[model samples]
Target: MKRLFKSFLVCIFLVSISINFNPPSLAEPTSPYIRYWLICGPFKDADLNTECIKNEANLSPVAGQKVDGKRWRRFLSCEDKLTFEKDEVFGPYGNSVAYAYCEIYTPTARKVKLYLGSEDGLKVWLNGKNIFTNNAVRSFCFDEDKIDVQLKSGWNRLLIKVSNITKEWCLSARFIRRGDADIKDLTYRPAMLYQLPVKKVEVSSVQPTEPKNKGMYDALNAIDKDRSTRWSSEFSDPQWIILDLGKPKSVKKILLNWEAYAKNYTIEFSNDKKNWTPVYSTDIGDGGQDVINFRRPARVRYIKVTGTKRGMRFGYSLWEVQAFSLEDK
Candidate 1:
């Protein structure tokens, strides 16, 4: 009995050490978070300071922390960006040496392009390793700095230092480009804020009202997980494609990959295959990959995209149709 007790104690001790020291990583893929936990200091060039830039633990974020002296919090630039005068809008920043750090949480390890815009000399670091540096004096433009970065599959650190001796002092950043271009295709939310798991859902059936060419382009091609194949509807006034997501699902987002034909369209959902409910609609849709976000979650099994206008004289064509559900994490 004494020997058995000693072995049990050793096993418990080993398990505790592993659990405390070896933190398991989240295997599921997650979007990059763009919200930032910011801390700034005013210094001068030629005599730069590296205290804040060296330690990342001081900058790591905690939920519901009040913003005050030495600690500030702000969300990244969404569709609109700030000019020189808007520097104070982001935080308590002034015309001098300032350092900004934005930490993003990703679920998968991959490479992404970090869109950043700033003035004067700037230095950047990712996960304690330097990735980008622009040593020049220039004006801040939208997407001024495009740096490719490899993000880990969990909590990642991003830090930036700027030396502004001329012009305005500001920064505009996004995971991708901003403005209407973003509206057309912005399905993934930045990983900075908390979000529920959302991905492409599987459909049980896909059908079109009228295919352009007889039996050539089927509606299933649009949902077959292939990009090259597409679904083309016959040349007519009203054409649409519908998908049944197996059973009733909680859907909150939709994507339209048009082939220069869909200039106007509407997204409708229904449960009993009748009494349809229109969730989102648009009149001017540029021919490209576009994303539509539903402010309210719709529970339905049937999802349809009805096109009213065409960019050209051709029929309404679609490269792909996607649906997703985003809930509180």
Candidate 2:
């Protein structure tokens, strides 16, 4: 009877532990894998480099829109590998092509890396510009290609054209930081609230003499899209630099990444390179990054910055200079 009672207490103890115990889970690392997309496909495409492929691959997709009788539909991919053949939108196709489109919104302009994989052949377009293409016949693998891309400050468009010669068809793509870290400030949307027609203005000329160090700290380094290099002036007050935008562009904001900053500076705009108008000025300046926004947009071809007081013992130096203009999309 004592043994039977002890067995009953043991059963009760086991049941109590089962009811109260919580198992530990080894959580998966955070990943920014794109799961939502708009897919349209089964187009007849044999050669990936032909004009027929180019015409179809460059297409901009809209949800519920029809292209060659195939309506664009929403696809939710639960797996990181987007297996189109296994999905309802596509099933067991051979020697054909398809397209996937997605939009990513960023709050700021930054450079990011794209990890992509495709079965058979693939082509990619970003913001109406063809960014990547491969005609190699291969199976789908995770992160087969790593492409560097610059994301604009607002909504950016990403389009993928995938081809399958035989068997299965699949693709995988995601955006990550330069060090392969997950991006947290991205929002996936099918449509943009509004679009900004922003393009890079070509730098026509730079003035205020060449750097004494030449290639090390040249005048062109400030706009070379490389933050590791910088343009530095001589160690003197009243140092200045001028940049010609080749043509008049509607400007609203300017970003200055400073290396050796200025305590007092004035930014001026000019149309003919001779006459200048002050757009922004500051007396108390801090180093690091400075984003200057104008009260109203200005149309100018020339931008000049003059520094009257140095923040440190060194001269005025800039790691990067960027200007932004927004127009109707």
Candidate 3:
């Protein structure tokens, strides 16, 4: 009896260790659907296409926390159907917007199919990048939309925005395993009020060739934050500009506002500025506001924009070159 009791205690200890330390791994692919969410809303005006509905989309929320001066709380759905009604969660008012935040954990990095359904309109962001959106008045059904998402190893943040146009306000999401290759080790957890590490960055200087007009079209104009100003290069096929971000930063996104755009270009990053690594390359380029989001953040101090083919007869003229990190940089 003593030996049996000792063995039982040993098994209990092992289970506790696995539950605490090995939280990411699972014995089998259990009920891997998200059922709990940290939600808050009823900010009036429920237009999914409008910016008003996405005001709190980028927030890192916790249970019982206040967002935009409104209280946020954790809500659990007993059934597969999820609701974000004005009176149910945070509303007694209609024609408003609500947000739901959740986290997913994967043992390995892989692409997975996300099946989503929603009523009215919806927008979704995974790891700070907008992945899916639909602006339509409709009823909710299972798998109304399917999105292919590449989730990195460990935890991935998911933010959902649902808008109500005086009717049903709800959304549902789940992961559909892709045959046998589907990840068996997957875990879904409630997002309570956790914050991810935010990367930092500082600009040191910008290096570009003498502009067509030195003072009027200077290299510094690109970073001046004024859309009216522009940095124009000499009329040439191959033009390049390098920006030193002071210190190494985890770069995740890049935005370029082009006046005279490049038809072919590559956005590269480096530490020593000698060896360059291309994060983005384009052969068929469109002249406009170009926004690039990297699946994985790159740690670098130097960024270079090399253009080979000009969209216009003039050289590459940029109104702004903005680099963004995970958080504020």
Candidate 4:
């Protein structure tokens, strides 16, 4: 009877242990890859700690300029530490001008926080707008820039320009949840967003051909679909940028993403491309981002911005000159 009791006790103990033991997890672990689109360059005589690196305006494919050996490649990072030593990344490189590193990611939550570390100067753009920028070259430290970003539900673009003033040009990035927890239960995708009608207008011209910085203040940059690139005229009044919308398309709205130059301006339209008529004029233009909607759609081929008075000592400057029609769309 004692032997039987002991056997029963052992069986009971085994069953209890089986009931308490937890099984291995069948859930898929989160990925640790930081996918990025990277491009390096061979540049010279560029400012080290400045917004110059962030703007790829003077780089290749812009203003007929090219970065001798500029090549873009897709990269996925799987390491905890990021570095650009004499051995690893674009080393033996001098002051670079046109280096670009960007990534588009979608997160489970609408809001996220990012942690970044870099050896030198870095500029970050969220949704094509400047958010955080460190235009100073210094030693690398973890969590150098901690930023909280509101991500759009579907997709968001993050553009980073890391400048290599010295030999060591490195960058590291990571995302965390609201409570500073590790990123989990998130989805990763290579983002290809649907583009709107935001691009270079077919034809753009400035009255004063030679602006303040002709290299940067090109009429082409204003329509290059880049906010960093802008068109600026001389520090004088009566400056205008004529935009030929290819052919006549309904233009009811005009968004002037200005750079604090034109305070008073008028929007003129011309159908025959010779005689022009003023549709709307703003004397109280505050000069940041002004969106002007016409009383009705203006079906014209030419649209011009004529500056009546100079806001500052500088002339008219436009970052992005865009036109859209709600009815046409």
Q: Across residues 1-329, which tens digit of lDDT does each residue of candidate 4 receive?
A: 99999999999999999999864321123334343335455355665444443354322222113344444433333234345443324455657643545544464436778888877777777766777888877887777788998777655656666766776666777777779887655454322222125323432334355456456777887777788888877676677887876665556577888885676888888766688877777778777888776433445677878888878886778898887642211
Please identify which of the two predictions, 3 or 4, would achieve the higher lDDT against the true structure.
3
Identify the candidate with maximal TM-score: 2
What local lDDT score does residue 280 receive in model 3, on the 0 to 100 scale?
A: 75
Better of 2 and 4 by TM-score: 2
lDDT of 2 at 120: 75
Clashes per candidate, residues 3 or more apart or on different chains: 6, 0, 3, 0
Give lDDT tens digits, candidate 1, residues 110-145.
Answer: 666778777766777777787777876787676777
User: Which residue window of length 10 is worst by lDDT in model 4?
Assistant: 57-66
Which one wins on lDDT?
2
lDDT, residue 223, model 2: 79
lDDT of 3: 0.71
Candidate 3 lDDT over residue span 107-162, tens digit each: 88887888888887788999888998898778888778888889999988888888
The reply for model 3, stretches above 4 Å from the true place, is: 1-32, 52-57, 91-93, 180-184, 191-329
What is the per-residue lDDT of model 2 for residues 1-329, given as tens digits with 9 covering 90 to 100? 99999999999999999999864311223346776678877776555554433365456667678765777876655457778787355886888888888889999999999999989788888987889999879978889999999999998989888888888889899999999898988987552221112223322223355567446767778878889998887788888877676766656578889999998998888888787777678999998999886534555677788888999998788898887654211
Q: How does each model score on TM-score?
A: 0.38, 0.51, 0.46, 0.41
Clashing pairs in 2: none
Candidate 2 residue spans exceeding 4 A from truth: 1-9, 12-31, 50-58, 191-329
Selected candidate, larger lDDT, 1 vs 3: 3
